[model samples]
Target: MTGICIQATHRRGGFDLDVQAGFSDGRVTAILGGSGAGKSTLLRLVAGLESLKTGRIHVGGRTWADAAAGLHLPPQKRSVGYVFQDYALFDHMSVAGNIAFGIKGSRKERGREASRWCERMHLDGLAERTPDTLSGGQRQRVALARALAPDPDILLLDEPFSAIDTHLKRKLTDDLKDVLRDRPRAVLMVTHALEEARTVADDIAVMAGGRVMRLGTASDVTDDPRAHEVAVLTGWRNLLAVGWMSGNRMGGAWGAVDLDHPAPVDAAWIGIRPERIRIESQPGAGLPAIIKSVRDFGPVREAECVLGCGATLTVHKAWDTPLPAPGTRVGLVLPGEHVRPLTEGRAMAAVDRCDARGRQARA
Candidate 1:
């Protein structure tokens, strides 16, 4: 099956974007970044809603834009499907009508295509309902169905789950994943939520400053040495400044810890997901800390601790786990493998290191 490849330049506000990306067929590639990272701008460029200053876009082996060659395809000419964040359904159209709107065929053929999409999206029972009467998740399903009914070669989703409630987001994400599985189309989704990206994407692109800072499989990018910024953006809780390092052992302001493997020198930050941290009643080859607070976040409990050296860390435990009360003394154990060494300096510097290393490894 064919996929999508884009190298585009566009201007938005005072920011200018120079982005190049490729989406593989039958896979979900998530565009992950912080706010104002130009994710939406990239989506608009792919959808043909924004004019490109210089670049090219190819979908399913067809060139849609080639600025140097003066080839630019309009939105209608490009076989792309777009599902907006707001569920931009037509107020005058019912669920079935909306799904059938973009399909080009006889009335019977359109109706059959709409019904198939409605069934696939679980909107059969609500086919007669108008957009206003549908719940948020239902409306989102309708929007997705409408986009898919046209049978486009590429799918572009711009924060597709942003408007849904937290409780429903997971379910919708799973549903969407099931619907897109094994389909011979390139999928690009933009989301600020890291958990959402983690759940739905096979590959991830971390964007910042109007450019893609890193792009790889989820594991490759997340495990990259320069992915501290991505981890921080993904809600990683414990980021301690590194004080020193000797061989495979590292010392931070909080405490000294050992790494399972050797890391490059000049490490600036130590990243540990709070959930990976463990707390014990007594100091057991770990840092001694005083519990500062216990926060309840429904199914999980979080204990905030301050080490003797003044550095703070957090540990997540099941709500049922017996947690130490505030003011209690505890030991914070960071296993060797969980201590990720972060590269020093700005975000792009790390990306440069990662790219260089990748090239050397490939060579």
Candidate 2:
């Protein structure tokens, strides 16, 4: 029942944001989007950095911004903590100094608060060190500790791990995840990194063109959605134009293939992850394709094949599998259940169909 609720409409510079979204407390919600998708703008609106043009923005039972009632709480007035994109640490401030900046109390009390967060963030010995001397990971932890030191009910993190190197980023992400798990406050972290979202977030909101196009749990968004839009963001390699066929089948690049369910009305295309594609060695086991290209990438070998329909699609095989020479004809094992029809049965229609199919399948 307690959460960050938002319904707002803000427009600027050819970008229009009109979304009504909610994120429960005691969870981390990652807003995933591409550059210029208004991810930061939404965060700013929640943080009170930007005024709400219309609708309400509420956090943890308190109304932060309600344009209908002309109520707008300034960022400083609201109980919120923010970790900026670059960490935003003061060059002159030591780690402890940065942490104590947002804490309200006597010097001794603030020092105690800072010390508490330092310990939680695994920054005991580095308290006296300035930002310039610390590594990117340390600086990030210090910034996080500083924001969280105040014990704000709502926390906003703007791509906190984007600047760090790969090795340090993973380590820092694990540390940050632990820090967040220990605390059950409402959190919203915005990032363009899919792996980070998959690793860190409990919930995900897929954003595009200044709005959340889809909202679901991490698994729902990543592993199961299967729609072309969500699939594209989460590693699907092929999204080919197609036409619906009879008997719950689709006609696309590789010709007519069966579907697990009825074809969605108005479907414009079909989606398939390259990894889901299987290359068969036999002559007549499956759809015919000829090897066209190959690339070796350690764990998996990627090969593109030209289908009889004259369309090229990529396929993945385990590194141990023998590679087919160029022009060698191969059969494709594209499962019906795994192939996702795109732009079909979206909105409430999809939900209704899903529920009905779920019941029918269970029955």
Candidate 3:
């Protein structure tokens, strides 16, 4: 299947976007990063909403941009469906009217297409409602239907679930996965939530400082050494900056630890999910820590522990598990193989070699 290939540079305000990335067809490719990572800029470039200073963009083997040749396609002619973060429905139009607005066809044909999308989006009974009358989820569904009704070659979503309430957000996420499942066009979705990316994307691209740091299949990107930084950005709580202390082992301020594979001394960083930390009543090979605080999160409990050397760690456990009271002493056990060594530095230069290998696998 033909996919999207983009390599471009653009300058906006104080930021500069120097991005080169490819998206696959028939799969959800999630663009993940922090606030200023240029996720939206990448989407705009692909959609022809932003002008390119250099480079080219191709969708399904068709050239939409070529700066050197002075060829630039306008947004309306790009054949791309865009769903904005705010759900951008027309306040003046009914749900059905909104979906049928820009579609090119006879009135009856447009009505049929609108009705089909409304049914697919579970909005059959709400066809006559205006934007103000629908719930947040319903409005988002309407916006999606409007974007897809035109039958574009590619789909672009910019934080599509960011505006909903927490409870409804989960349901919308599941609903979106189902909607995008059988779509024939390529889809690129931008979000900072790692769990959301995991749920909806087959491949992932992690961007920072207007450049893609890593891009590959979800599992491969998440398993990469550089993924430690991505995990931290995604809200991972416990990341230990450890390095090789001996053969097949590493050492952090906490203690000496073993690894499934040896990593370069300069490139090693150990990471352990908070849930993997086990608190033992007896002395063990793990680090000795003092309980600092305990907080409850629905069905789970998180304990903050301070090691003797002053490093803080969060341990996650079931609410029913026996937990140490604040001020009690405890021990921490981290699995050996969980440690990952990443390349040094955060600059784009450091990611070049690693990203080259990553791009090959993804392609």
TM-score of every model?
0.86, 0.90, 0.90
Question: Tens digits of per-residue lDDT for model 2 on 93-189?
Answer: 8899999999999999999989888887889999898988998888898989888888898889999888799878777777778888966777899
Clashing residue pairs for model 2: none
lDDT of 1 at 114: 89
Candidate 2 has an lDDT of 0.79
Please report, in order, the local distance difference test score of every candidate based on alpha carbons: 0.81, 0.79, 0.81
C-alpha displacement of 303 in model 1, angstroms?
1.2
Off by over 4 Å in 1: 219-225, 280-284, 344-363
Supply the TM-score for candidate 2: 0.90
Name the Cα RMSD for model 1: 3.9
- Tell me the alpha-carbon RMSD of every candidate: 3.9, 4.9, 3.0
| Model 3 C-alpha lDDT per residue in residues 1-363, reported as the tens digit of each score | 467777778889989898777777898999999999999999999889898999888787788988888989999889999999897889899999999986889999999889988899999989888988998899899989999989889999999889888888777889999999998778999999887888888888888888887877888777653645666665667776674468777776777667778666565566677887778767664888999999999999999999887889899999888798999888887776665655443643423221321221244
lDDT of 1 by residue, 1-363 (tens): 457777778886889887766667788889998888889889888888887888777776677877888888899998888999897899799899999999999999998888888888888888888988999999988988898888888889999999999999899899888888867788999999988888889988888778877777877666543556666765667888888888998886677889999877767788887888888887564799999999989999999999988888989899899898899988889998888887643444312211211111110
Error of 2 at 101 (Å): 1.1
